[model samples]
Target: MIAPAAAVTTVPRSVRLGYGVGSFCTATVGAVPGLLLLYYMTNFLAVPAWLAGVVVTAPKVWDLVVNPLVGRWSDRTRSRLGPRRPWMLAGALTLPVAFFLVFAGPSLRGVPAALYVGACFMAAATAYALFEVPYKAMPGEMTHDYHERTSLLQWRMIFIGAGTAISGVLAPAIAGSQGAQGTLASYRMMGLTIAVILLLAMLGAFFGTARAPMTGAPEPDRGGWREQFAAIKGNSAFLWITVLACTQMLAVSMMLAAAPYFAAYTLGDPRSTQTLFAALVGPMLLTMPLWVRLARRFDKRGAMILAALMFGGGTAAAMATPLFGALYAHVAILLVGVGIAGVQLLLFSMLADVVAADAAETGKRRAGVLTGLWTAIESGVSSFGALIFGIILSIGGFVESEPSRPVRQPESAVTAVLIGQTTVPAVIIFISVLITLKYRLRPPAAPAPAASG
Candidate 1:
């Protein structure tokens, strides 16, 4: 029989706040690449659209191997600080250096520059995996209370929204300017600024959770990697949740990748992209508590279904902006933000419960392995979003131009941008809702008692 979980009954607010701050690091790293990397490669570095796609997508292939290993490694580790904190600390120190190199590569053009940027980004991706997998695992390790897990993740989601908004607003405003070289300089400056913020946020999480209680002992050495893989294969709930989460992640990534183009081509002003992004993300902060309450009152899957409908309806309404003007589009985007908030808050919370349930069934806590797989799928699919949008742009015959010389897109390309920004994500969100319905996980239960001798 499975043993009862020795989970911390109450986590301090300070610890929760500290953990929540780590989202700032994740959001800054995630947002910068999704929001600007494709634009940087094509517009500033002058790489072809197809090549830009390859460069951005290639580095993430590393995560498929690294994430699982890191996850398992942390599971086996025994440390003075904790199994996860060392990885978190190491990631905190190295990520800033990698972030700086991503934008500050030597002045080279064509394949050479693409190679340099790709190599730098691979390092950044590694650092992110090291931090993100362990950090995600903590929610399961920190508490076993089903409702409390949702509450903890709610704070993280709130900060995620805030951090996304900060990066969305600041990166564009900093990078907006006159010429190609000037724009490059602006990106470099923005990179450095974001790097500092990432470091500080990560450090805060490391120290803040230093004394938080751990739930279970590390699993004893099993057969090998095959055994580890087998563990994940048996968890049907985790598999379904991964699919549902990955679809939402891909949709969000595609929208982020297409936002600048949509602003330039459809809204007729590139600067407006930042404002649109802010509109899309700001409401998430205010709406997260409501989402958390909904999840607590009903169920995460139900909340996700509601979110998907809202997101699809909002996206469809935004597609009609050409007829009604930018004001109508902004309101529609706010609704999308609300939907995104619900999805983000509920998905991770649900994953924590899935992990707890797995522990109950198997009598081992392998949160790292599960969280690793989760992060790997999330990173891999999101990166592919860049490639998908790139193919769309290439097929529509998008015009490539330097910052100093703006080019007007043909109607076909403009239409492609609009479709990418709207219909694509709306459809993906609906599919995610369908997948979520298949997820069947019970709430946390007390362990059954051992039989008498």
Candidate 2:
């Protein structure tokens, strides 16, 4: 069994770049819904708040069952194209199908709506898992170099930041132009466009590194599912990383699901959702290179702590929206987005490192299982965010059919929504930071930085 010590050389730049692009567009499959689906259900399609929440959350069950299987299958797969590319091709082609269907408006006003939306979401979830799980595992296959992996992840975040901004800004605009019902049409267009982008990225990754050196398979000592399970269960670092990753995803999901409602009812600017989103993310794009520099100087864990605190502080500042009005609230939220970008970017890098560390210890390249388990946990977090927020809204005196106007609720209700989106997540992110502190993996003294293929 070879230990992936700090002595590994850096990943090549071209491989890292190619992987980053493909992964970014594929990841958009997961993130696009988080940004727009809630808006579609609540305002455009006219689903009730409670029902909308359920519709939003119902697909995660598939994630738990499907994601791991795909991971395991990828781990065991032997192909001329490589373990990940075949699935990547299939995912890129199929993703648009599920993406288009999710926005197909069936009057989700009653049982029929619930069933319809639930079915659509399930298809989309499965498609996303197919695309995302394998897509995520590619970085590990791309390089064994520690610093080079970080560089690859850094480039990945750069592209992810760009794609996410476009999708977030465009989804609502396209839908709004066609009217709320036309939101479905807008969604269809977005899917087709993203699918094309993802396809191009897939092509890059597939062809760019065809001649590159391949990573060796798992050691003979590691055999079958039981061995993989033992490796993960026994690895304390992997366990903690999964927990922290899930919690972080949960915090993000709640905010993504809740932001639409908060913008419409709380801030009273439904149109401003895009503006707020852009404000939040645009700065992140501009500031990411700075974050990359900071990560190099201070380490990813410390940067994550700074980001969490910044996000928490921004959220706390936004709580004063009633006093200062929407303008100030928007600025505060923008700051929150900037903070979140660092966390989002760093989390991917951390996961890659964790995968590397696991392989080093376990003597198996179980990247598929690790990525699979990570996706499964994230799926749970996504569903939990939707479910818990729905329950919270019901308790907060939020009524589904009530016009978009703000309603008087118990102080607790307002406080609850605010805290759920802000304070709760802030606390969680902070706790995640504490947990990451437990990681003692140090990079090589002269570590080779990760790069794109």
Best by lDDT: 1
Per-candidate clashes come to 0, 16
Candidate 2 lands at a TM-score of 0.87
Residue range 1-453, candidate 2, lDDT tens digits: 124453454567776666667655544664677766765665555566678777787788678888888887777777897776677677766766666666665444545766777887788777667767877876665566755666667777777777767766676566555642345566667656755665676567556655544453454233677876787787776677677678777877777777766666667655666777787777666877777777888887787778777776787787777788888978898888888878777777777777776666656667878889888877777567866776787777664442343345566656566666666666766676677677555554553689979
Model 1 over residues 1-453: C-alpha lDDT tens digits? 123456546668888998999999888887888888888887777777778888888888788889988888888778898889999988999998998899988876667878999999999999988888899989887876777888988889888998999889888877775442247788888888888889989999899888776664356334477887887888788999899888998888888888888787888777887889889888778988888888867777788899888887898787897898878878999999888888888889888888777766676767888888888877887788888888888888887656656666789889888888898888888888889889988564566789999
Provide the overall lDDT of each model, using Cα atoms, as 2-decimal numbers.
Answer: 0.83, 0.69
Question: Which segments of candidate 1 are over 4 A away from where they belong?
Answer: 1-8, 177-182, 217-221, 445-453
